[model samples]
Target: MLNSSFDTASPSSMSNMSGRWDFGGEKEPLMHRIHAYPAKFPAFITQKAVAHARERGVEVKRIADVFCGCGTTALEAKRLNTDFWGCDINPVATLIARVKRNDYQKTRLEHYLADILRSYARRHRLHYSPYLKDDRLNYWFDEGTILELSRVKAAIDTVPEGKYHDFFLCAFSNILKPTSKWLTKSIKPQVDPDKKPVDVLPAFEGQVALMIKALNEVSEQPGKPTKKAASIIVTGNILEMDFAEPMVDLIVTSPPYVTSYEYADLHQLSSLWLGYTDDYRKLRTGTMGSLYHDSDFNRDIKNLNATGYGIVFQLYDVDRRKAKATARYFADLLKTVRQCVKLLNPGGMLLFVIGNTEYKGVKIDNADYLLSCLVDEGFCEIESTKRAISSKILTPYRDARGKFTTDTTSRKVYAEEFVVTGRC
Candidate 1:
């Protein structure tokens, strides 16, 4: 399923002096477009790392992505036959990952698709009150559009519990940002006035059909060997997870960018529509990120108000220029990393996919700083890779002024991300 054999890097290519492997190109074979997020790495990057592990005579049974946004890592893992475990603070994202990774019967998926469509057609005309309504709905969509989405979601909820249920729930989540008035200003949702709102029923139907096609294409491929284990994806905070020591093989993830996209606020429509929360703005403050972080943390807005610093330093002292936020965030990150390190088999690898962020012109070399934490905590920096985000095939979102209106920088290039590997 992976095209790694044709593109594997030679030993000479692995040198740090080469700077970073250019994982550039428009032809990302993995499922990057399954759904759109403001910032997500191509699945091929993960493919490269996994291939590197195999080349080292290492047998990888399990792969875990803590910030499994939109399931990029999990999807690639399934394609490569690696036992996959994923976790995310967003419930909707975890739902998407589960639906994509599950080995559902192909015939069953087709049957389920047809059955749900027919069921939806029968119920489409029924009148019903909106699931969760607020002023935002009035500001975002007309009455007809809301009614259409409500009926479709209600019908989807009624699908018999099985593979179909998971698929439809994810489909519903995917449809939220696109069909509503949430503008393509960026990954985050902003109510758009100039653009016409899309009709809900047709949009829902199109998504279902698109999903079936994607599922069919992916399931047709033969898979590689895996750990024969099912990865668990939790929809709650990782801080609350009860994991025993040494519980994972490898840790790979890209946490939320500093002072960049406001994830919860961006997906407020989904949160509101799916019964996660009725108060939309509350998402901005409740999450431990961005300027919205609690005052108790003393987040530095001039530093792009990044949260989660102190929790990280507890694992290792950070040598960054500024240390404004409480050590709570860094401490929590170390706790999670320590849990991941404990989960690994001896000599297991940790591949961290992170970015150095800039907020109000302050550099937050988070990736490098994070690697330092790992190194200080009994991990060895084996190798690292850096790549420009500009080289990848992007969906190309921008405003008339040729600026990224939604991103915090409002510049052509926003932040730089990296893939740093450490061995324990």
Candidate 2:
């Protein structure tokens, strides 16, 4: 019941591909620069996928991204004047995505910025009582830095409730890491003990200006405005949310890599500062590929392809617990794929942008497994394209044990990723 076609082109064959297909380019859309979310695929990828769908005569109307991290696909859909719906378990990610898609009046944003600045300047000696009082907070920031950040929060509280409120809050959220001891370039939340923190007010002000510029650009784009597109970004786990019926026209997303990035830990600054969660560690439990659990692996992975199981078994020799975790990751992804298929209408496309990575000493062929799983789910026609990733927010190198590493000598993983597309 599966129809599969293979492309056996060697790496040399892909070398002449267009730059738009390559994720390594330096140029990125201004709107996408709102936040430095780890593992975010470039906007051009979505653009190309949509173009290909049009060529195939698929009329695009409603687009959904179940694992919409920071809303890349949703934003692209908005630009094309398509109705968009997206969900992510990470509250911080949902917040950024929601704000990015909002079409705020430029004058109103400027007025709010002036008022917030005036309110912050009026406070001479702000107390930090309202801020999160976790030990991790103190560890990441000095007392004076914390106090200044409190002033910023206090000023943001003055903004009236609405999109403006969230807009300013997102600006404040963007400045948290730059004004803290967190390592600026590291994907993982590692503290640079000797690094000096930037002034929260100036950093926040600069970020607000950048956001406004991006917002203005979106408003001026041709065709129907983004606000008229009926885009909705919600905070919900993809596995639990019910789409109810086959309504979506297209599904474009890049699910989290297996045990690669701890999203909760990486976003602790935003989570604590935005009051999305008081306990960052607790947020990890709901995420896929979470290492926090020790439960027995699900033995019956109905749709996981042979390559997936083979990699897990290989990892078992190095570490049984890790292998079990890998097994659990694939099982969860399989469930998500099935749910996505339910929501997609007949002939709709599911484009998955995923990368292969190593676990311990074994290579996990995520692309192959994903293709196989989609075929098993009754996707009629399957095609995939590979592109070299010259740079990404996520570190490319990992240690021998599959842990993210900064050392140059560490083995490199995930230099290339595949954009696998399947039609229902």
Candidate 3:
């Protein structure tokens, strides 16, 4: 029988067991500030959980994040000198994570930046072929801004192969939105016509400096003089990847929310600029909840044993396509959960940082459904805590039609999220 002692209490009732889990606090660790990811969980959450496990005499030798977005868990694991493994469908995310965990010489990066600046300064009016074209290019950037960005790209291309090159490329990627017309405050990619584009060179230089500082801070942490832990980051679909039985000691991840931010569309600026793909929409198909219509899937939704099926069935009469899409999302997530269960060692802990949100006027209790899935997969509930999200990067408001919105007065979507833990 499933353990039933855990309480589903409100955020206000939860104790500050691990102090405050703050992402934007003044004392926030610089390691997680490497890149801005949509709805990324704070590193403090992972650290607190690991500390608790250690106190209970748990041997956390190998850690894995099935949907490791930008490698927050992996980085923390590395700091603690534990082997880490992570995978994601987003190539850009994998690239960022790999670079974040890599130990690069500060002097090498300084020299590379100097070379790029000198090369860039020599080109008084260098004209290079634009990497992107048509509406994709014009929609987010003006001609002048695109030209300046192209120059920076050309300079980045001159860096020698290996981690040094990837480091500069990541820096360039971080500055893409700020130097373009994309809305700065919005998670979804929306062009702000009135937004002024910043100068590419200075912005990129500043980002490089910040990244170097963060890297140095991480390396200077007081600990054993042991060698750095090995980390394996892969670009692959989570549902299809395999981890042999009893491979991982712990799993920490935040899976993508249903009908939330379209990750492929959100990262288009970096995708096109970095030449990861010519069509960003093509990358959308494999992602969860990418199918918006009934024709997109061949499977029958009625076959899945999901607690949220009743809500989806109700949605069918209102919007058949969205209903099928929601069903597909759950089906995909279940497959992923089962895969994760198979990989984890006996008694290993799986901690998911998830939030419940509404879809097409139907309340999708994502956290509850995930808990049910875990129980069905043979995991016992340990403890779950609901905490208020003080500062969130994802847009919390949805329009009347159940679409994400930037409307200031729109209803709040996920002001709180549950950090649920289960033992296999």
Of the candidates shown, which would achieve the greatest TM-score relative to the real structure?
2
Stretches off by above 4 angstroms in model 3 are 7-26, 55-57, 132-134, 291-300, 392-396, 400-412
lDDT of each: 0.62, 0.79, 0.76
- Candidate 1 residues lying further than 4 Å off, grouped into runs, are 1-20, 24-26, 124-128, 223-229, 280-288, 298-332, 391-415
Top lDDT model = 2
Residue by residue across 200-314, what tens digits does model 2's lDDT show? Answer: 8789989998998888777777675525778888888888877678878788899888777889998998898878888899788768877775546666333346767777878
lDDT of 1 by residue, 322-360 (tens): 233323334445555666676677777777776654433
Question: Which is the winner by TM-score between candidate 2 and candidate 3?
Answer: 2
TM-score of 2: 0.91
Rank the candidate models, highest lDDT first.
2, 3, 1
Q: Is candidate 1 or candidate 2 better by lDDT?
A: 2
RMSD of 1: 7.1
Question: What value does the lDDT take at residue 67 in candidate 1?
Answer: 81
Q: In candidate 3, which residue pairs get closer than 3 Å at backbone N, Cα or C atoms, i.e. clash?
A: none
Stretch of 10 with least lDDT, candidate 3: 10-19
Give the clash total for candidate 1: 18
